[model samples]
Target: MPDSISVHFASPAEMLFTDPQGRKLGKDPVHNVEYNEISGGVYYQESIGNPFPESSSQNDESKNIWIPEPVSGQYDIQVIGTGSGDYALDILTYDQTGNSKDITQTGNILSDITQEFELNYSVVSAEQTKLQRIVNIDIKPGSDPNSINCKNRKEVISVA
Candidate 1:
């Protein structure tokens, strides 16, 4: 993995909701991290329909929420719909090594809003950089793509 973890989603039909516009990611209330847009911090990007105004590792319809130094606890991911359509939600995590895996969800939104996901992530108390802290929390259980981070793949049990 790298040094950032993100929760993001996207839909193709303009957007899910008209008033709220797109998704809003509410971080763990216990963690209370500040939200910033210019500098690197916890910030939410509301989508402006497909064919995004900018280029990214993500597709045109996607919007991302970054947690470069993810705080421990529960995270609430919500999708607000303008009407109704399908959407993809993902938890993009980086391992201590240079590998990544996305925990993804694809579903339909048939109401004003949908709060259908919860991530209860706990992590290691490493005495290192914020970057190292990110690596500590991205725990990938069993054999999966993220296991690329483990030196002894079979011995790697999830502590976080």
Candidate 2:
């Protein structure tokens, strides 16, 4: 059987609190943005934003991508980023004791950031582990004001 997990687009401001009377108050927690096509608008005041995908400079040190509390089992990790300029993908694993391991493929991938790209990966096994990886994408443009930063991003859906 394949276990499934969903990564939703939600705001950081969701939490539940109750008074001594145990009355539920405040707005209902929202996990996804509501869009109204008839009104040609987004209905909610709060919007779910994508995480900023970044790359290290040539001379600067690289940072480890961290996905804390990865459940033990098989997982399909889908990393998506702006496919506009340059990009690289790397996968790493860390055990419960914080020992790190790298599992990145050594060659160019079919998914490149010069356009839009999505890459699927698998986590076959783990020992009290976490996945620390990153899909680093960079966008650079010259002269044309119309050329701007590419910013769409998505992540993995796991099957246990």
Candidate 3:
């Protein structure tokens, strides 16, 4: 059995949060975002906003990635923004029932924002027969011009 699974991001845009000036303003400079994981009765919390430093040159450092003990059933993955900018986040997890669910909110969020992305996988044991499951997430462009910062942005997820 696997104790914990690793979540990987292919690009910085999928992980990091940037400012209007394109300068990194978060503690996790490389990924530029904050994350919190709730699993196995443990409540792991991390602040996810750019408490803008007094000076533009000042940097507040923090962790961008989280790895928690794997739970057998559904779990929640939460993402929070640090500043007023465009954000694209990718989250992966397993669901015992293997059902698909999607939740999306697109708009010009003046203040801090929080979004949830869900991943589901069937429950299979070592002694049981091996099977393959496919999960797909499709992101399309919205009509709102002011809230359309993620245009032409593409991200892919593959589970085996």
Candidate 4:
């Protein structure tokens, strides 16, 4: 069996949230926007890929990507500011008994801020960890994270 993990978030104002695979959640998502011919228009569809398909939908209050059998690895969960506002991001764990617990949370955050932290996870018997807080933001052809001050590494995994 695999542990249940989800990365979910919401903001005071509407903005687009994207997962590693480019699936998006938002009101009128211009990035990764998918057309729903049956609805007669387009919408940002939350897509859960790889091991399994998405079984739930993104609601008005929140949006999420559920990893039912998260492999032993690391991936980025991103927030793209189409609109701007303070937001809360949470990692949640669910038990088979129908209860949900928050594993971690980053709240009331503003964009373009940097802070260091560690996030870790396990699947079956494999555990992995990641360190650092990194952000890549795109401004109106103006503000960008100074390349000299930025650092990145390939996602790391550990198992025992």
User: Which candidate leads in lDDT?
Assistant: 1
What TM-score does each of the candidates earn? 0.46, 0.26, 0.31, 0.43
TM-score of 1: 0.46
In candidate 1, where is summed lDDT lowest over 10 consecutive residues?
13-22
Better of 1 and 3 by lDDT: 1
Cα lDDT tens digits, model 4, 1-160, are 2355565666532333232344433343334453222211122324334343364633335555455544433444444443435566666654443345565444444333322333344443322333234554322332242223222222222222
Across residues 90-140, which tens digit of lDDT does each residue of candidate 2 receive?
445544444544444322222221111222222343233333334453434
Q: Mark the regions of model 3 whose C-alpha exceeds 4 Å error after superposition.
A: 1-3, 7-55, 60-69, 88-110, 121-160
| Per-residue C-alpha lDDT of model 3 across residues 1-160, encoded as one tens digit per residue | 2333234322112232222223221233235533232332222223444476664643322233333344343333333444444443333333333332222223222223444333332234212212121223353344333232332223233322
Worst 10 residues of 2 by lDDT: 3-12
> What alpha-carbon RMSD in Å does predicted model 2 have with respect to the real structure?
17.5
Q: Once superposed on the true structure, which residue ranges of model 1 sit more than 4 Å away at CA?
A: 12-60, 95-99, 125-160
Model 2 misplaced stretches (Cα beyond 4 Å): 1-65, 84-86, 106-160
Please give the range of 10 consecutive residues that has the lowest summed lDDT in model 4. 35-44
* Position 57, candidate 1: lDDT: 34
Cα deviation of 122 in candidate 2 (Å)? 11
Given candidate 4, what's the lDDT at residue 76? Answer: 40
TM-score of 3: 0.31
For candidate 1, give the lDDT of residue 17: 13
**Superior by TM-score: candidate 1 or candidate 4:** 1
